[model samples]
Target: MEDPVNAMLCHHGFHPSMLAWCSMHQLNLGIMQDFSGSAILLLVRISFFGNYNAEDHLRESMKECTRRFKDFCKLHSFECSQCWLTTGMLHDNQTGWPSLKLKAYNARIFLMFVRAALQAAKSAREAQGLEEDAELSYAVMAAKALCSWFALVERAGRYLTPEQAAEQETAGLVFLRCYTFLARLAASQSIRRWHVITKFHGFRHILQSARLTLYNSRFLHTYVDEDFVGVWIRLSRRVAHALFEFRVLCRFLLRLQAMRTVDQRSVPARWS
Candidate 1:
């Protein structure tokens, strides 16, 4: 409704939309934290290694996967990170959303890959003279759902057309479906440690509210606020604590005032 914030909620807005700025970012952060202990990425990890919950095999698999990725990049001349997806994906990591993003990303087969695979599957089916949809592991679907979420956030805007809104809703449902899948899997596996947080459920509300409204939750993202807070933290550390809050406030305000006074005439003075 009004300047929809992260996860999007306003005083005038009813339920479903979460509190702006605080909730959605926290949801991402919260998911990141929980992922370290949960089965959220189990299927993706298993793709890297055949083992489940095998912490010992994680590094070996990561390095092996990274090596393969590097080789693939070199052979194809496609760009890739130096370390690939192995950095934050290690066991005992407190990785952020970026790392989790990497896991989700692995599921999004490139168009070329998808085409080739589909062609192969189609050939196999035709050869067999059967008409059944290609069977895929649930992991593939779940992982694709996460990728849809990433796509959703990347395309976030202040407003959306009806079609774009439908797309948004689709992405959100895909993501939520993955959550549901994981919840069910965890229950079946008796993974007692896994507990979904409120922010997780808040995402559904966010999507529902958005469908009713037109606010894009990712446009005015809260990450910049988080970064600004980091700057204040570094500045605060340099300031004497004698009048800590006051001193920090004055310094920040003065800096803002000085910048506000700068214009075209101030450029020469600035460089001079």
Candidate 2:
């Protein structure tokens, strides 16, 4: 990908990858202006709410951050920003899926990437069990994403009525099952159950494509002009390895959830 950060460093006469990671670091002044303007507008709309102001500010800032990310993608021609936005919206269902669904192609593609990254992260985590591989960063980020995942699912569920959620229990279970399977797979075990997720037919393909795209984006050459091939390759491998480790950790979380269910059933002392 030409390491855009490195390119910027060369322009600034600084060492490779040494620049600060400010939101404005890679953007042109125009993008920054647009971001700040939108941010102020968003904040202004919510200024009356004292306590909720911080939450609104956080939401607005995240949207602005996404906008800045979009600008970066446009400049770099990577189109990765779309995937990020979709995934972000999915992780923050409060954003409402309507806007994202309007760009369904992009949303689907983004989900593919998320699934792939999640799969790889789960795999690595299972394999290494958090010993900190070179790819620990990828796994760590994926785990972080899951922290968001719970919030997203809870919010998304709110959009549906109780009956709907009950009816869709199978669907939710399917998603969780696939998540578990991937986690277990990362731990070097064969996946024994696929019926839940496989019923949709193309879902697995979507996941595979996402994984391949992620793998290529991280590991393969993005340009013929760059000479840091060896270093980039090493970086990509580390990302993949870390992602695997993270996924396994997520599996542990699922197990913990299951344990909680058992414990709740066993303990009755609080009320008594």
Candidate 3:
């Protein structure tokens, strides 16, 4: 009899069906199963929220999921095995499955950022009901979270091997998603904050990171399914363009404000 876990591994990296199978069987398949299951559940929850206009209850559930996943990562921090007996033929004792481990770690990091983004968004939204000072406090919290996540991504490169870093599909998707989130956050702030232009530099950093990830993943077009690759490319390009345009608008607004300030000062001097 074939091991069910190995069967699922052969099918494709990790799929909903694989998670379902493990859930149905009540299997204790260790860290791989746990991490894959949590990641898939997070994806499912994200899909359920659709565009992240989530209801309060849905947001709470997302927070709960994030907490669970974080705890799981802490507990399993030292557990980095390439394969298990349950993986059967999929277990290559030769190459040692370093790529798989890297993918899993990357997924975990992606989830962490997503969780933080959600929390920040929620805090900003709730700030609308608070005092003026409270609102600024919440906005500052959101900005800090966004900056921290961007820095985390920069530091994450040290964790990857050259080959794992080159596997664009895995880490690349995470980068694209994070960049999109940051762009959206910037757009929201620009609507209310006149001084938001100061934050444009952070968006620029995310855009460059997204571009680098997409560039490295260009080879994915030939190897991956054409339709899937096309969709990824389109979404990435759309986000990149949106961020670029917003940054330009910010600079333009700042320049106009500076010019107006100089004109007002000169008018007062002429009157004097």
lDDT of 3: 0.37
Q: Write the per-residue lDDT of candidate 3 for residues 47-162, one digit (tens) a residue.
A: 42234454554444445444544555566573333222122222224533211122333443533443454454455546666433332333334334434433434453323334
Against the true structure, candidate 1 has what lDDT? 0.51
lDDT of each: 0.51, 0.34, 0.37
Minimum summed lDDT over a 10-residue window in model 1 is located at 103-112
Enumerate residue pairs that collide in model 3. none
Give the TM-scores of the predictions, in the order they appear.
Answer: 0.52, 0.22, 0.19
Winning candidate number (lDDT): 1
lDDT of 1 at 234: 79
Off by over 4 Å in 2: 1-53, 78-102, 108-178, 181-202, 205-272
- lDDT of each residue in 171-225, candidate 2, tens digit only: 3334444444434543454322111222223323322332332211111212221
Candidate 1 local Cα displacement, residue 62, angstroms: 4.0
Cα deviation in Å at residue 96, candidate 2? 8.9
In the range 1-272, model 1's lDDT, one tens digit per residue, is 67647543444666753445443354455543344334323423434334535565665555555565556557767654345445454334442232234322232322122223334434555678777432223324534554566567566555555676677778767756655665676678764423466666666766665566655666544655565687688779999989999999988777657655323322223234
Residue 66 Cα positional deviation in candidate 1, in Å, after optimal superposition: 5.7
User: Which regions in candidate 1 have their CA more than 4 angstroms from the true location?
Assistant: 1-18, 21-26, 32-47, 50-56, 65-136, 191-195, 233-272
